[model samples]
Target: MLNIPLWKRVVIVGLVALGLLFAMPNAFYSRVEGHNDAVAAIEGGAESPELTAMEGAWPGWLPSSLVNLGLDLRGGAHLLAEVHLEDVYASRIDALWPEVRDALRDQRATVGTIRQQNSAPGELRVRISNPEGIAAAVQAVQALAQPIVSLTGVGERDLAVRSEGADVVVTLSEAEQLATDQRTMQQTLEIIRRRVDEVGTREPTIQRQGNDRVLIQVPGIGSAEELKALIGTTAQLTFHPVVSQTRDGSQDPGGRNVIYPDLEDPELFYILERTPVVTGEELTDAQPSFDQNGLPAVNFRFNVSGARKFGDYTAENIGSPFAIVLDGEVISAPVIRDHIPGGSGIISGNFTVEESTQLAVLLRAGALPAELTFLEERTIGPELGQDSIDAGKIACIVAFAGVLVFMALSYGWFGILANIALILNVGMIFGLLSMIGATLTLPGIAGIVLTIGMAVDANVLIFERIREELKSAKGPARAIELGYERAQSAIVDANITTFLTAVILFVMGSGPVRGFAVTLGLGILTSVFTAIFVTRLMVVIWMERRRPKTIEV
Candidate 1:
């Protein structure tokens, strides 16, 4: 304990230096953040003299990462949104219409004329013209049934086909509904994440709540309304072949065709085929652009498969009109003048520039599978966060000062070494937090204060042991060595137990509790290092240089 090797000494000093260097950036948090943002903007293809100067202000080689402040410390928007999973079920049933029609049409003689009837939200009802052929019609539709992939219903069919009166009703099975809900929730989460990330905010907390809801907390956003606006729309875009144009939305457009009102003129409706030629899922990119008439519009391009399908469709129906549908409303219906081989086209809706840009962003992020209904929302003001930060700062300073005074008065010069180690210990905690990008909440400050008080336990144990050794008439050097050697086990045992408790808290807790656990955990590690390695190094150097023959505890 008294004599550390040359390499060990070098390592100890190197670690302390690195900790100080990494923690230095947090002292000027805003400046470092500005520098980081400027660099990010430059990388994102935005260049200006001001951004260049800001980037140059902070050196690139220096440690620039700062500890992320939690939502409680930095004001933001909080929202609880319930995903409308039931909405997808109805859409799924509607989409199955085309498939069911095509399958039954292949065996028209056996199934006879098949017509759809009104059914429940998730059920598809087909009225068979020939009631005697119900069994064969059921068999034909059963061939289209898929196996459910859920664990509880692995061998079950995706659809439940049954006869109700003269109509055959097909509904999603329980297992299939469960699987669909899971997929819908996952897709909604991804789309929401993409939209939030597009706004360029840092460290937004987006997590699943229950089975059908999501909790979103975005720090630095103005209000919950603003955050909602970023992700409110469904943005479902599709292209359908136009059946006819009419002034009446009440008129039936014929079998498997629907009438959708024009977005600009509600009285005018376009009759379109229910099966779309292409959907937004095949879109690779969408950008805000100007149309041929210099109107604000969105330009979209398709992936390889979409391009081939679109190219063939346009080639076969050059003079036929296609309607561009947005959320069941026809935006435009234009005749296919020529083969659009490249699979890129413009959507002209006479939109404002802002609307066009927002549409482009939504398209690029992809459409939400189901709508999200905001259940709870609130805005956390910056004033409250500032007050909390101030209180936490005062608590930490008082705790730090009290610890310094107590340790200095108790063990004399050795206590002073412990205090120095304590300071370095705190610095190392911050350094680790910043390096790992861990969030610090108000509770995290309390953890730091707790750490400051606990940091001197090992030193107290060692000092008392040294006094006992001195009373037995051992030499000062032997007494010091025996003290550290004897007290090491107790120090390790106590800290190890405390560290395990912290790990449990971290694993089980969320939000501010997690922030507290992080700091508490890191504090335990740094305090142990500083107490054993740092203070011992200081004492060893002092003893070696002064050649003290006797010492007082």
Candidate 2:
């Protein structure tokens, strides 16, 4: 009665062989990882004899994918950063100044010369010489308000314009503020990812935490401080028109201009327009290079739109000084000697080679929307991760040995079949992890250990059911069939519930908890297949060959 079709037999054997073959690379993890990296570099257009030889060391047809170790299992840096969303609000209001001034100017007969007033960061306030026209000024500014294009901001306006005493105040509506915050966070996450990726670190975890936070984990990084230094720079690069050069700090430059001291010469100051001619977001490329004087500098190219704007500005204001501001400080002020037609230009300053390179990287990665406040930072040492791996390996071996010995003493040869299936189950788990490129953590190791016990528990249940059926009038073959049939419902129900729990954990938890859920969920699947199908096939084959008349439980 126990028989397997030829196709079914082939399928079972093929799966086991394929799993082992794919999982083989993990045995030589470092070598395989090196091979993979070398291959990637070649694919990325890097040509080197050493990399070619390294790629040749591994077989071309074989799968080179390996399970990535998580921050807990590999030395890394972990950072929790809170984005300063309010910073965007101030900039948003500052940006609206030009439009507001234009709109008020068009209605000059009603609202006389308009002047901006000092207000809160997110609030925009304006005063007109003709206080009687305050109502008209408010109406003019309100014309600029548009409907917020967000699901939660349905039917709500983007800006809230109001008349306060003799001044008109404008602020972002609640719905608009929410939408802006979301966009700011998304932009911040993207820029951070780009910056981290530029360094070519492997398998870095960059994820949004809450509404205004981001969590970053990078493996093999030296410390949290190093990671922070790499990504923490605001890198707000802006180009503004220089009004005048001055030594006096107390003198008022104008309403829309600002006076910033030179980085190299503190006594020297440049009064520059607040609004930028172009921002770093329009940069297409930035590279560290030398200036005409052989000084360290960064050369940048702009996108089509940025180039046109910059080209026009330089053409109209020949010989006028243009200030390059970095994070609110004037880095360089260079006078436009000619109408530069091309989008490419150089930024020269008192910079070392390293500073120039760093600046270039930042410019290429784009500027962050808002500054990030470090809420938490931690460095995980490689030594500690190694110790965890060592302990986990010991625990796994101990659990595996105990299960094998117990199953062998209790069920004899049938237990031997289950043990074989258990070994294959573990292999398949690794194989799946490799194929999917899942990250392995210390918690994942614990999940694997727990799976060893569960794998045998199914066999124990089936074997006990056989022992009970043997007491009836049925023979060995009939009793075995009945035992498996009776155990099916119980095994399926138990594993299904546990699998669902694992899914829930994965969805609700973060970091290590999710890692544990991954292994636990995959273990359930592999163990179920091994216990129900693979073990049954092995038992059927053995029985067909031996054809035992009577069998002991």
Candidate 3:
């Protein structure tokens, strides 16, 4: 006889019930989404009347996880940017300058007085008083070249130190340049991800498009300009010793000093040392606060290593002004009124509360390694997404109705059983998606509709097999058992091939294609389960209860 075991029947019913229960939230997507967002805000210490209302809309014990909507379905910002690797190269080369100068000075007797010769960015040059000492100068500078970890530069020095006339020319080797580019790209992606996550956006796609380019697609954000503004700022904070303060733009600068305009008064400029005493990389925490005058400010704390350097710098430079530089511009040049022992300071400027909060967020998230030049930027509106969703709903409804009528007219009572399985198949897909937090795009919706039509394929094969067995003098129970046994191989083979195709699409495709693959792959799984177990169990129970002598397909 055609019978499912007691444990198998219980498992089949339990799984179906659990799937429908979890998928129930999606029936009211907006209400459930609001409830989830409100719960998150409350956990983050936010309070509002609207949030309470949203939180109460759903039961506290119910599942709130939703299938995240993709950028095409939720509508937000999209951007393509090119990372300026040359900026990183220049910074690395500039840092080597001090070491180069110190190394050459150690051989002062041979090289005489060493003068730094001005060169292009990413290149360092040192000129010696005596041309005959060039060999000793080159040897001293080459000693500072450190080996880098890279395929082409496994053991080779990163510096290409050579002598051009009387000056020792120092530039990054090709291998080091490649390694630096890779590091810069990785760091940029991580920092951008942190910045976006800090704002609490969902499922933002921050990925590297090529060697030098990044593609950002953040769903549920307002605009591409807003997103660019969030991550575009380098937020490079440094404290430099001031050389001089002047209003004249034409004021000459020393070869070792740099000139930057004050953040408050652009007419006033501060000439400062090129190297910083403390950098933002050491910052452990930053928060927005109010200064003594009740003006908006940012308070920052540094790590242990930074605290020692900052304390020493402040103790030694009492009564001297130090410039706080953000992205090369002097935000404030404050005089050290006293010896500040702790490495904690306040940055007070002409800032609104919003600006101070944003500054704190940027500081806490850390700085970008280099600048990003946007090559493409586009913002998609929610209206377009809603329209797409509406069209998809209509298409699914139509296909579902057509399939239901055709199956009912063709297969009679067994057709109704297949329809139930098809409904549960879709419900299980949503449940699995929500459980795993997968994203659903417009193409993903099409996959679900296609699955509805294909969900009955297994039932059709088994029903046809039963018709043939009944014609060969088999009773109802024998025909039913033989039908399922005969159709098992064909059903498994067909779905296995389709599932493999879905896996390949997911692995090889990007963005929307991947979303489609996810839904399609998940649908295949649920369809197979419902067809093989759910529909068969229903058939077996009906046969046991009714014990009909004959059946029609």
Candidate 4:
């Protein structure tokens, strides 16, 4: 028998006890009382004032925030979106074909006609009068190719090309298209994750689904409309000169001036047409604040280059108005009264606090590459989440009671020891989750329940082994030792298979499914430790005291 020291056993128990003690508040207590209370002042918030205030009261120990629950259990929004890769590919090809045509023209190739063909998907056909110039034209077009490749016929001088379907199909192979698609999806996912993170969501789940879709799940998020507004709108900011009207039946002699729609007066203001000196991408920071008139506005600061450009534009067009256009709509158009030397400027307009903040966030994050459409949206209320939690708790308690009774009735004192270890195992899972700040979903709760059943299977294997060894006339201590040794392989094999399944599920699943996988994986690991270490420790202690000659199952 592998003899473990009493001190080692005591230390393990003490550590488990300490974990349970620290996890109590997270598992049960409410440190925040009011909804309007500052998030930082409430427990589980980024900066808990209560924790700081009580830091001195609890000596040499840090107060932790409450463990956050997931969307299913906590009731939150779920969104599934299919990214329109086909449209993206089409736009890319359209842009590329123009460039290719221009390049062909530059090559001095005699171009007859170039157009997209409906005969083949993603195919474009180009016909040229000069057969000798075909080689140079193809070379020129090749320079701008992305997911497209050129093909020359045996008897014809025409060029035929097709796109392999990517975000930007210049002239790319199938492998290259797949690679580009993966990269685009990954980059978009990162951008979305950053945007969601900026919204102060806790444990938000964002993952890529299939080759062209993304799934986002936010727990405890009640405002589906707000989230949809924030995420679905592709805030593509651009600066376009307003088209000017002519006095006569001819075009205006002066440049185009953009027309701004007045929100209050419904009057149109024709602003002088000026090319954008700088884009919003040069912006460094943006935040909502009140202007001199105390109206809600967004204060924005640009980089050095942007500041210089803005200053120059303001200096040159002092009397002319410039419009702040966002997503094709003119939000504000104020004449340059004075030169703006610094990179900072205020956008004064009619805005609520939420609108101002959202605008600032969008500007800070930069413009999206393409427009996004919302295909699905769902929200879970807090009341629904509470009910789930209540149901989960009842189910777990009943499961625990049933398991405890079955073990005790079948295996006697040893079964009671196993039950104690099982309880401790559950405590450890919660404690670890709290320590790591893992979000617990409804599926995650199911994972724990399933783990309880699996964990008992390991105990049953060991107990049956002990019974068999005792039937062979082995002493209690020897039988216990042989039981653990014989059962270790079977226990490890069974758990390993389950662990592999969890790993695969985590890899392929999205959102709630992933949460379930994570919880199941963690539960299995902890169960192994408790079933082997804690159970052995208890049995060894009992054997040391009672010195039973034969074991009973």
Candidate closest to the true structure, highest lDDT: 3
Worst 10 residues of 3 by lDDT: 249-258
Report the lDDT tens digits of candidate 4 across residue range 71-145.
877777888877765543443443345566677567553544443322222344455555555655566676663
lDDT of 1 by residue, 1-553 (tens): 6879999999999999998899999999988989999999999999999999889888999999998887788889999999998888887887888888888888789878999886666778999898887888788888889988778778998888888766788888888899998889889888988998998887888877789999888888888899998888878888899988999778978656778999999999999987688888899999999998999999999999889988999999999999999888999998999999999999999799999998999999998888889999999988988998999999989999998999889889999999999999999999999889888889998899899889889889988999999999999889989998898899999999999988999898777777788898999999889878888899899999988889989
- Candidates' TM-scores? 0.93, 0.95, 0.94, 0.77
Model 3 CA deviation exceeding 4 Å by range = 150-153, 248-254
State residue 543's C-alpha deviation in candidate 4, in Å.
2.0
Deviation of model 3 at 261, angstroms: 1.7
Is 2 or 4 the stronger prediction by lDDT?
Answer: 2
lDDT at position 241, candidate 1? 94
Off by over 4 Å in 2: 45-49, 247-254, 294-296
For model 3 the local lDDT of residue 141 reads: 88
Off by over 4 Å in 1: 150-153, 243-261, 266-272
State the TM-score for model 2. Answer: 0.95
lDDT of 3 by residue, 416-459 (tens): 99998888899999999998899899999998998888888989
**Sort order, TM-score high to low:** 2, 3, 1, 4
lDDT (tens digit, per residue) of candidate 2 on 1-553: 3566889889988988888787889998988888998988999999999999888888889888898898888889999999999999888888899899999999889989988876778888889989899989999999999999889999999999999887999999999999999899889888989998988786788888879999999988899999998899999888999999999977798767778888888888889887789998889999999999999999999999999989999999998889999887889898899998798898899999998998899899999999999999999999988998899899999999999999999999999999999999999999988988888999999999999989887888888998999998688888888888899889999999999999999999988898899999999998988888788888888888888888987
lDDT of 1 at 461: 90
